[model samples]
Structures are given as C-alpha cells and as structure tokens.
Target: MPLLDVKNLSVNFNTLEGTVRAVQGVSFSLKKREIIGIVGESGCGKSVTVRSILRLIPMPPGEISEGRIMFNGENLLALDQKRLRGIRGSNISMIFQEPMTSLNPVFTIGNQISETFKVHQKMNKQRARKATINILEKVSIPSPEKRFEEYPHQLSGGMRQRVMIAIALACQPKLLIADEPTTALDMTVQAQILDLMLQLSDQFDTSILLITHDLGIVAQTASKVIVMYAGKIIETGSVSSIFKHPFHPYTIGLIKSLPRMGLRSQYGKKPLHEIPGIVPSMNENISGCWFAPRCDQSMDICRKVAPLQKYIDSDHSVSCWLFN
Candidate 1:
C-alpha cells in the first residue's frame, strides 16, 4: 500500500473579504522509500496542500472543506489532536523551510533535538542526549559534542538545516515532508543537503514529499512530479515524462523558464522564457480553467469549461482542453 494517500482534498480560508479556496480536489499517493516533488509558483498551494495533510493549518480561518488524508490505512483527517500528535514526529515528520525560525533560539541544539526523543521515544535525558549526538553525527555535523551545546544562531545556515533534519529523523518516521528545505542555501550546500536527505531516507526506508519551486532540484531528486497552478494540480507524471513531454501549458512554461546550460542573453539573442500574468486571486470565482487567462495557447473552450484530467499513459496525466 502507498505510505501516504491524499484524495480529493479541498482547503479554504474564511476571511473578512471572502472565502478563498486555496486547494481544490488535489489527489496523489506516495510509496515506501519513494520521493515525489510538488512544484509551482509562490501561491500555487504547494505548501497549503502538504500543511493540510499534517493538520497544521489553523482552524479559525483555514478549513479542510473536503478530503481524505489516509496514511498507513488510517484517516488522518479524522484523527483527533491527541492521536495526531502521537503520529506526528514519531510516524510522520516535517522539515520546515527556514531552520533559523523553526528552531528555538533560547534552547541549545542538544535540548531541541533531545526533546524529540523524550517526547516520542520516552527516553531519559541521558539516553536522549546520547541519541541526539548520534543523530547529529549522522547528519554530518562536525564536532557533535561541542555543537550540541550551541544555539541555533551559532550554526551556519547549512549546519542549522542539518540540525533540523536530525530532529525530524530522530525517530526515523515513515514519511518526511520537506517544504523548501534548501531554499536559502548556496548551490553547493543545497546539493549536499539534498544528498544527505536521500541517503538518510534510504537508510530509514522513508517516503518523502518534497515541495519546492525549483524544477531543477525536482529533476535530480524525485522519481515523480506533480505540477500545481492556481491552487490545483494541472499535470502529474513520472519525472522523465513530465520533464520531457509536459502537456499542460503552465508546466511547459515552467520547464522552459529554467536557465539552460549554454543559453545566454547577449543583445536579446537568447532571452529567458517566462510565464506571463500573475496567478488569479483565490477569492475570485473562476468558472473555467484558472490558467486560461495566462495561457498563450488557450482555446475558447478553455475559458468556458474546465477540462477534466486526461491520461496519456498510466503514469502521465494532464488537465487541459488541448489534451481533450
């Protein structure tokens, strides 16, 4: 069975202005030790969808309008806070985008990491400390003993991120959600972090839901890819298929926007490709395809009727009138 399955998930936020539909009928699955990447622009619901899986979205405004989030045969959406708390960190851990903010400044690295062990594993302080150091070493943080006593502010961005990973993997959870885990790091550090994640995931036999805006990183790391636009999935397929033959106009535009190896702009000889137009507001009630406004190849039908998901092959699917 797939380790994680999210079906027909719709998320909305009730605001003073109006209700904003952030995620609409998003569905996907991930298997053991597999990595799937979700890619899109800033407000495309990549983070919101994953956050919903963990029940991290605040309830005052945000709500799961409809959906089933099944993890290991259990409906996560139905679980109460107590059971969900038990599952979180122990069964499914998440590494947020920014470690500087994620990690508490007052607590030492040792205290922060050992807290995970104490909370989930119920280990004594001595044992938790030992385990924290071991995990620190495993994540390749130098001088584990000395670093354990240091604060989050003392570590470099890469080292701080490693600490976050160590904490998330402390219990060797079955699934790990990495939301833009390498966003602000240098290219070298980013590669190292990605490699470390893959290595550790293999060791732990964990499935990963890697959410990022970088298509290049997804190309190198994920086996499958899901493309989101205007709060809905526009295309999904194996990495090879999505990168090589993108069917959705938005997906194709995203791939084209990546800087090529030898491509350069000298006197406008080879300008970089960019998708035009901003994403529509969530409050706007889009009657048809949300991407129709910005799509250069949009047909009359695209603006009048929302297209259904169509499959080119078992592993590839797209939602576009062109495919119909």
Candidate 2:
C-alpha cells in the first residue's frame, strides 16, 4: 500500500462575496522514500491541498468540504484536533515556505525545537536539549550546541531555514511536506538544501510531498510531477513523461516558460518566453476547463464543456480536450 494517499480533496473558503473553491477534487498517492512534486503557478491550490492533509486551514472562513487523507492506513481528516496534533509532527511533518516568519521570535531556537520533544516524548529538559542540538547538527547548522541558544533573528536566512528543517525532523516523521522549502535562497544554497532533503529522506526512509512553483526545481528533484491549475489538477505523470510528452496546454506553457540559460540575448539576459493572459478570476462559475481562457489551442468544446481526466498511459493522465 502507498505510504500516504490523498483522494478527492476539496477545500472552500467562505467569503462575504461567495464561496471560493481553493481546491477541487485533487487526488494522488505517495510512496515511502519517494519524492512527488506538485508544480503550478501561484494560487493554484498546491499549498491549500497539503494544508488540508494536516487540517491546518481554519474553519468559519475555510472548510474542508470533502476529502480523504489516508496516511499509514488511517484517515487523517476524520481525526479530531487532539488526535491530529499527535500525528502532525510525529507521523507527518511540515516545513513551511517562510522560515523567518515561521519561527517564533519570542522564543530561542532551542526552546522552539525542544517544545516538540517535551510535548510528544515527555523528555526532560536535558534530553530535549540534547535532541534539539542533535537535530540542528543533522541539518548542518554550525556549532549546534551554541546556536541552540540563539534567537531566530540572529541567524541568516539560509541558517533560519535549516532551523525550520531541524524542527520538522524533531520526531523523525515518516512523511515530510516541504512547501516551497527553498524559496528566496541563492541558487547554490537552493541546490544544497534540495540535495540535503533527498539525502535525509533516504537516510531516514521517509516520503516527501514537495510543493514548488519553480519547474526547474521540479525537473531536478521530482520522480513524479503533478501539474495543477486554478484549483484543479490538470496533468500528472512521471517526470520524464511530463517533460517529454506534456499533453495539456497549461503544462506545455509552463515548460516553455522556463528560461534557457544557453540561449541569451545580445544584452546577456536569457530570453524568457511568457504565456499571455493572466489566470482567469474565480468570480464566475468555473465551467468547462478553467484553463480554456488562457490556452492557445482552446476549442469550442474546451470553452463550453469540462474535460474529465483521461488516461494516456498506465502512469500518465491529463485533463484537456486535446488529449481526448
């Protein structure tokens, strides 16, 4: 069985104007010791999809209308808050996108990391301190013993991110969800962090649910790729199939949009291509295919009737009129 299985997940946000469908019927399964990348532009529901797995989105404004997040053969969505809390950092951990803000400014780094051990393992201060320093050391934080005493502000951006990873690993969870984990870092640092995550996952035998907007990052790190648009999954397949035989126009546009470094303009800037037209607003009903408005190859059927997901191969699936 898959280590983590998320199926037919839909999340909506209630607003004064109307209900905003942030995620729509998204489904996928993850295996232990594997990396799956969810790739899309901003506002594509990638973040919200993962957030629902842990029941992180607040109610009143946010609601998980329908979904099943099966982790280790248990339904995570059905679990109450207390039960969910027990699983959040121990069975499945999240390393959020922003490290500078995610860390509690009022607490020392050691205090923040130690909280998990104290709460879950009921470890004494001495043991928690040792585990905290060991986790920091595992993530390559320098002089972890002393760094543990420092506040979040004292560390650089990269170091702060390492601290975030350290906290996520406090319990050595079986699955790790990294939401844009390497965002805003330099290229060298980004590569190092990504490589480190894969290495650690292999070392600990954990699965990874990687969410990122950078296709280049996905191309490098993902064994499988899920392409989402607006609030729905439009395409999914192995990295090779998504790269070589992308059937959906949105996926094609994204691949084409990647800047080719070898092909530079006279000005020495890489000539980047762009997909014209912004993503359509969700104000009106999302009839037919949501991407039809932005698709260059959109047809009458694409604009008027929604396309159901079609299987192209055993492992490749796409939702587009062209594929049918």
RMSD of candidate 2 to true structure, Å: 1.9
Superposed model 2: Cα runs more than 4 Å off:
265-272
- What's model 1's lDDT at 183? 98
Model 2: per-residue Cα lDDT over 123-143, one tens digit each: 999999999998888999989
As a TM-score, model 1 comes out at 0.97
Tell how far residue 69 is off in model 1, in angstroms.
Answer: 0.3
Which ten-residue region of model 1 has the weakest summed lDDT?
A: 262-271
lDDT, candidate 2, at 29:
95
Q: Assess every candidate by TM-score.
A: 0.97, 0.96
- CA lDDT of each prediction against the hidden true structure: 0.94, 0.89
User: Per-residue CA lDDT of candidate 1, range 194-299, in tens?
Assistant: 9999999999998999999999899999999999998899999999999999999999898888877655543435667888988999999988899999999989
